[model samples]
Target: MRHYQPGSVVQMVRDAIVGRCRHIAPRTFLMVAAAVTGLVTGVTAYLLKKMIVFVSKSVIGIIHPDGFSLWFVLLALCGIILSAVFQRYVVRDYVEDGCSRIIMRDLRERKYYLKKRDMIAAFMASSITLGFGGSAGAEGPIAFTGGAIGSNLGRFAGARKSDVRLLIGIGAGAGIAGIFQAPLGGMLFTLEIMAMPMTTWAVMALALGCVTSAMTSASLAGFRIDFPVGSFSDFSLGLLPAVLLLGLFCGLYSVYYNTTGNIAAGLIARVRTWWGRAVVSGLMLGVCVSMVPMLYGEGYSAMGRLMSGDYGVLGVNSVFSDMATPPSLILLAGAVLVLKGIAKASATRGGGVGGDFAPTLFAGCVAGFFFAQVSDALFGVRLPPVEMAFVGMAGVMAGAVRAPLMAAFLVAEMSGTYRIFFPIIIVAAVSYATARIAERVIRNVKSCAERAR
Candidate 1:
């Protein structure tokens, strides 16, 4: 290895690259930069996912696979404590509420510099939380990490504000693409979820970034769709009524989801010390997880089990295992659905780190499954629980995150087909509308109560 003069060779190389960049069209340069960002974000997503999996497998290895073990609660509590300590001491930064932070910065159109630690802090914290069964998703943390990567890249290149903002969107979109391997879904996420205005060039850049990230992740991880609805003849005009009802149910469920999360966070925030918050959250989460083992982690495996018609897995390693009847299983699903939001809130607010995407999707699956079972048992109407589960995912996510297009496209891509696209679109629309109305009513009621006081 040869040593160069300080600020000599490095500065010369930087100047050379900057000079070359000046000759290129702005759009062309942006596209190139977006692709590079996508590549980097993809690798980061892959690494973060592997970290979670490694920790998750290790934790699961020690647990009794066939029966309930009290160790689940203890191990999960340890994870929350460890994550809180790491964030407070090692990271020494504010890394929570990553998606909200990004949106606020974008809405304000402020020139904020995301620190280098921001790129890795959420990634590490979320992995520890989820790996130890902290009942949350990875999507939000990865998006935050990706946005930081894009922001820092723009800062390094001295890009304009508009360009930096666009890059941030691209990175976030690519991050989702990398994690889910859904290019179209990723583009929709950036456009709808991020509330970014899209021009022809911007759309092109976002698409390129998302596609490249998806390709990279696929190449590295060997592409596989987690929940695949192989063949279903259950979607018809007769089922349309059920679909509509499910949509309404999901809408109301989304209201509960948002409300529960907010309430839990608010309650946890009252704790004066970080350890106190962790202990409080840990007790709540442990009780939920102990009673319903399916509530642990992102609950993807539980969702898959439901989709495949193995409802018994919902009660695995939990107190509900003995109640294996269909009606009882439906009730168990309902319990998991409600408890999931609380568990997710506990994980993130209790010094752990995670996202809402997984929890909402998990709840949607449960809601759909529960509705199908109850409808058949009560009214003697048979609806496909599997298809309903899939559509419910889109509906709940659309309402919870208020991104119908993103939710619809994400489900479509996840299933690798457009067979259920029409139902997904309808359900997502209904759910979003219902959620909006419910939120307004709740807001008015609170206002009235305050005025009376």
Candidate 2:
């Protein structure tokens, strides 16, 4: 082959100059720009949450409070109708609200706009899911929307590729922090889950975004427990076995949540019609929801039950194990988990858009309750289910998202207790490692299939 032309060197130099101009835009400017992203996200999340809560509490209360009685039949019908319409018509083509789809469509530049829509939509969707009773969290929706906006802005603003990517990451971190009011959790969430490889730059930006958003949210919300999980003491030599066992058990429960949730999503996906899926899911969930109101919404009421230390049927770990009873409460919890998984997974899979963060906590609480009983009978250890419930919540959440640090930190922040940090770390590590190994197995299988094809 002939030698390359001398102008090749000139072309390379031209590209370098353009890149320098893009990255050299002052650091101060970038920080301020990114901080604006946090500011807007914080305001939006706060306002939207209030509106959703108001709708759920005030508007819905006035409409229907007596569970599908003849007095509330029309309201239930309207709820079903709205659910069907939105699933069928509006979010029909939007399967998964997945980042992969957004990227494939070249939405890097359109992220800012997407964030706005996502935030508002998450607010409305969460309200509907909770208000009339679908059972989910606003965190996922908020995160998705925030990430979309930040990512799109980068591309649209003509920033360097690295800058765009970093900004997108920061946006996701900001959303997590702002909504949850958990700074360390938000930073770790980005590093372990959102960012691809966890680089130094990503850490810096993520930390900045999280801190900024959390502070903004705190200032506005007056710094209370945004969402309380659980906590424990006794990280000393005496409690090693219990702590380690907690981790192992939590990992197993996380696996259950992930596998079962996926199964529900698969079922919904196969239905071929969004309305059919929605109606079926809604009805299935509705029937059981009448039994254990804890199985509905974000399950905050269930959490309250746990905090109150009541071991009765309505209590946190109070699974109806009687084998008698009309609609067996034990079977009811299992069925509710399956159905709730569908409501959450299907929405994400079908394009209604959101995340699976809340499901793990629900599963964890249930497992903690179950394990509490097991420990008392089998192991003869009186592990307080309330505290262990938080551990389970963190562990499952860590495993599902592959964010061990965030999971551990989330529990600590919720309880304002650092005494159990060491144990939390251990449990988190186990949950994350186990889930990662499992994920790799699936990934490798997929790769092998693709190569064979």
Candidate 3:
């Protein structure tokens, strides 16, 4: 047994190392793998966001410093056309519901693998879609990209099939964390929206990934929060009823937004060719932008202004330079709040590569501000619009996505304080409950109709 060559000891050590690695618990290995995934996903998300900003500023800004001009509209059309051509000729397939696709793949195949080419294609398409004023969000593409990265990494590391799904969740959460710089929000989104199993091990892994990713992005990006609404010292128990009413309103509006978006998507789906859909959607979007101008891009700039009490600043940097009276501003805001969802839905279904994530937030902002304006006009309530705007943001997100915890945490994190935590929670809970009830009612009605048929 003791007869060994000079290389025998080296080979024995190599075997021992391999054996040790094999002996590691699957959960332990998955946790470690998740950390690596989070790191990579965070870095990738950071770079992707910067790329979008650079493209939007350098390309779109140079061409149309005043937003939603004819030049901007033409460029948006061209970008959509180019994206359609790329999808047809090069990618050959476009991912519509990025998160849903990832979840479906794992459910059907028991394994997940994101092709390198698909990741690149999604990234490029999303960049072009948003950079050229497509009314969409970056969250969907970024989440998909993160899942792809995690899936591939897990496969490379010899993780089990089940473990790969968890890794995908971890990466997705990390992506959200990176984008919003909100670790808790990311974890909750993964748990609630992605329907990630809530085992202790899974939670730990997701938390680890989200924290790592958020920290990574924050460190690199200097920890900038998206919308920083100032302090809210006007806490009034008298406003509780109004807050509840606002929540109900937001829930109803969410239903309307979802219905409108579905209808728009169905209509757009009638187009057989990608370029045809692009042209139709592009023309529709151009018409919308030509009128509102603030409907351009993700509407974040408009949202920020609303939160900062800058009502007269609508289309400030855009082509519609005419400042409006307070009454007209209210009407314009109402129009934007009503039509923005349809526009966003059209963009997504009409061959534009973007996500519904940002649209929901935009709708929430509009709903909140609209509620404030109405309250001030009707009841002469001295309610703070900014505070209501923040609440509305949480309300719409919760109702639309059915993720109250995530929505609340996201709003809190974005606002850089938890002073309004109670209001945020109230709005989120009410909106979520209302949305669920409404969905149930719709389902019952549909079922009754089917039975009658």
Candidate 4:
């Protein structure tokens, strides 16, 4: 009913549709803030890695009476205890959880721009988790540090909520990318795992921010920081069926992962007393640390060894049939998986403020290791366990996030050559579907049981 201005109609329409694009006078300030957030996450991740390696080396050196103090073991023990203590008494940092907390905080709460003071506390919490030989990964802390910087910065800078969320994703992606030197994976992960089902425009914004942050982090760290990955063999056409089979196996395992994780979270939530939970978790972790040697730290070194070749035979006691038997390492891998679950749940319940994604990834990798071994035994043929291991990684991750494409892309971008990309895709898709079906079935049973109770 309103008459449009003679020539102002177009301008009015544009204003209504596009909204006001506030630039704040287009100052370099916002750009700098974003870059700074990325840098902080990157530098923190890099530094964290170095810190763990340095302290870990010292710990190993101190193992002797005179010259060798075996301080690494003591440090490990202390670090484990301290982590338990921190979770219970310190930061108390569990917010939204499932995939990663950083994602949850940024998207759900609009807590953009991480504050330095807040980040340092988170850094300490994660450092203790790694220092004490706890079976965890660095991704959670990296994301936490990144998210804090982004959330705090945005809050201080007065950015729009959308912009702030993007910044947090960027920082988180950068943090993870820098550590694994997997820029694309980090970017995709932030988009796929961190953000909720996004609109096209929002997806573009998130992906761009995450990717840029990852690239910046990689530039600061290195073009590609090489770490030990699993041993991948030459691809053979004969392995296609096995690859598909392996993918399905991983999917089933992923259901186990998510289900157990939910149960663990529920268990922690049931407890009311923080210190009581912390002390109990600490004692449990201490006993686990004492009992299992490889359950400590990031488990990278162990993962590399397990993936480099295969240990044949069935069960934990089997000798390598050749060098590709994965079955024999099941017990060892299973131990790490169990302790990681305990450490993660204990930390959340007990008081250590952190995310569970890292622990989940670590457990997934170990589960993948076992899956590859079992597949080799069942078929009586040695497929490329290395590639299978990587497939396992994506599969487990897919279960958590329910994003098969992203999971596949994350792994391929991180590790696969051009040649193996398609195979990785195949594996990830199968794994995702498998996990989804199994999850539905398990949830149905669980619901029924609860109703009966």
Candidate 5:
């Protein structure tokens, strides 16, 4: 037998694979690539989640929930500063707002290719940010990472730009589906949030990718992401009024969140130095988290507790724990709903890397609970808090993200039932309409003022 160099053997194997690929039909190749992208994206999502969890447990897990500690301020500060430094020095690129960046690139540049570094940059930066207790979500960075994976894979295969775009969507959809274990939600996100034009082939590819990713994620994590739910209360016309009011409440809250989030981000952006921004972000987060400990991290744990009827989780680590009475808890929940947007913006803009997805849902959950309490106290309307919270999650998310169907479907998947599907749709629709109307009013008012000047 002829001895071959190790390098020669690798090259021969690569040549064989490439030679075989050349014979495969383009559509078949694309479909195979989509499946591979989904599988890889699922792994990426799992790793990102594990990194965040490990970091969080190492840092914040030491703190006692029965009492208060300002150490979280330091942890939050360090996390943001580290993420900013990593982005500026290590990555040497802007990797935040992955979704927006992807959309802008596709629309403006017609370039479906992303740098290879992107596959890991957002993952590392966001891991550090969330691990250190930054109030942001992992979904955005994973989506960005996934898109890069798909884009690069297509480009490597010498695919056309249109084909590359489809790959990008597959990667993104797979990422969302993997993280949330909601395949339909993931596909909808690409179509609705990414604004990808849907074709039959595109839909099929997305479905394959999303389902694969979600299955991978579920297998790796050993469980699906879920929220505790109350017994399915009978839906009656009598409950319609409360459902409508909840939708309106969610929409108005979404507007407030968007407006304040912008203002907060703008304020932080004024800081010239990375350290200055970090300090400002740290101080802002420190104050908010100090007041409401649930403001720390993505607040998913708190959301779980809220859904499970454990209201004490809201005030447990808070300095305001002394006032954990029902009335005080209601007030605290309202405060969380108000401050979450600011906290999220501060973390993301202040050199930390994360997405708004979790923060939006967390705020929605709190908003629903707060509304339920206030309604019960004032009007004696005995709405199920758990069910209302579930609906509110979809409503505010729908309004804030401007993707009603995705939001509704995501909630359906999380709840593991379609019993509440119709209510979610009703709330999502009203919330979307209300947000649109409010946003238009705000815009026209601003324009009028500008014209007057």
Candidate 6:
């Protein structure tokens, strides 16, 4: 104290703060860290989204206004090449689908760590992929990035391995909540899909993270509902049977979707070179986009247009003189439903750094629209297609991810309505049941085939 210098005083104060932080209870420290992580994750999600939009407008909008042009192919090729270069040079041997893998690893090993370079590489790669019409979604990469941030932060704070895993979930949930502006959905997604134990502390941490992220995102991006369907106001008891049927169909479709994705991924995996895989996938995706322009990118804008009955905007030209014919519309919508699954699968398989969440939602929209049209045509059911589309979204998500509660709550939050909760629950339950049955059947078939061989 008698020989105190300015530098020594600053160092002493820093040491005192560090010492105080070290003495803080683990639970209190976790809670505080989680809040900060959520805020940071929300800001990251918002900025990434804005960047995608800006780049998309600048690259795709200026070059290819009609959604499907030769420019689309060229731009996609360039994006893929650039992503490969970045991954190779900046983040060596980065894992694909990093979020899902991280969650699985954390569950199995109860340890989590993600390098800062990997996080940056994922964010950059996904932005480039989506910006150039890669036919994928941003949710997966964002979630992974959030988890990386949380894991690194927790490690720096000297958290235990188990608590670090929980922190990863907290950050991931915050990312989802920020993107969708649905805090409950984000929390449930982490708890259900990630299979995190539902301890009170875990739930508290996830909830706090999701709420903070959602609030931050809302403040920055405004509180606009994700999917706005204003035409469907009321629910009808007569729709239960129809909703059940839709759920069953959605489950079957989900199985087909999963199968197609696996097949495509396997085929693409045979190509050893990243550049070759990127080029081939880019070319194939380009051809598909040229044929069905609506299949480009995340397909959210097209879904919104479909919900609002703006089919032309989606490049669906009417063939019949009477544009109101349900059959013609049904055929177009069905084609989209089928093609979209294939295109999205192909895109993901071909080195596109994106997630299946948005593509699944896109397929759900097509299925719901097709169901409404078919029911009106065949069963004389005048159910609103927009409402059916929303239900289909929940059903497909439940089946594909096997998380009915998460799907139901997510759709409800996205729609900003509790009016359709009953139908959402019914559809989600049935879809989940159907998907499980389908999985068992496929397993049995495969076992029988192997035995015969």
- lDDT of candidates 1 onward, in order: 0.84, 0.60, 0.78, 0.59, 0.84, 0.77
Q: What is candidate 2's lDDT per residue for 241-306, written digit by digit as tens?
A: 776777777776566667766786677667787567665555545554544445545665565566
RMSD of 5: 2.3
Q: After TM-score superposition, what is the CA distance of residue 3 in candidate 6 from its true location, in Å?
A: 15
Pairing residues by index, what is the TM-score of model 4? Answer: 0.76
Model 2 residue 311 distance off true place after TM-score fit, in angstroms: 4.7
What is the alpha-carbon lDDT for the whole of candidate 1?
0.84
| Residue pairs with backbone overlap in model 5 | none
Give the C-alpha miss distance for residue 136 in model 5, angstroms. Answer: 1.2
Q: 1 or 6, which is superior by TM-score?
A: 1
> Which residue pairs collide in model 2, if any?
94-351, 96-348, 96-349, 96-351, 109-152, 111-148, 111-149, 111-152, 112-149, 129-134
Angstrom error at residue 63, model 6: 1.4
lDDT of 6 at 118: 50
lDDT of 3: 0.78
TM of each candidate vs. truth: 0.95, 0.76, 0.90, 0.76, 0.95, 0.91
lDDT of 5 by residue, 1-453 (tens): 445687697656655666777899877887888999999999998898899999888876676445677887888888888888898898787775445455447646777788888888899999998888888888888888889899888777667788888998899889888888889989998988888886887789899999999999889988756664745766777889999999999999999998989999999989998789988997887777777788889877788888988888878767777776768878888889888989888888888889877888888888888888889878887888888887899999999989899999988886677887888999999999999999999999999999999
lDDT of 3 by residue, 292-403 (tens): 7777777777788888888765545444456566566677778777777777875666767776667888889878888888888877876777888888999998998788
Candidate 1 least-lDDT 10 residues: 95-104
Predict model 5's lDDT versus the native.
0.84
Clashing residue pairs, backbone N/CA/C < 3 A, model 3 = 67-318
Per-residue alpha-carbon lDDT of candidate 1 for residues 1-453, written as tens digits (9 for 90 to 100): 445587687666766677777788888889988998899998888888889999999988887456676777787798889888888999896565545455447547664567788888898899888999988888888888888888888767667778888888888888888887788978988887777887999999999999998889877887877676577664578778888888898999999998998898889899998899998887778778887889888887778888988878878887678788878988888888878878888888878888777788888888888888899889998888888888999999988989888888887887778887889999999999999999999999999999999
- Model 1: how far is 128 from its true place, Å? 0.3
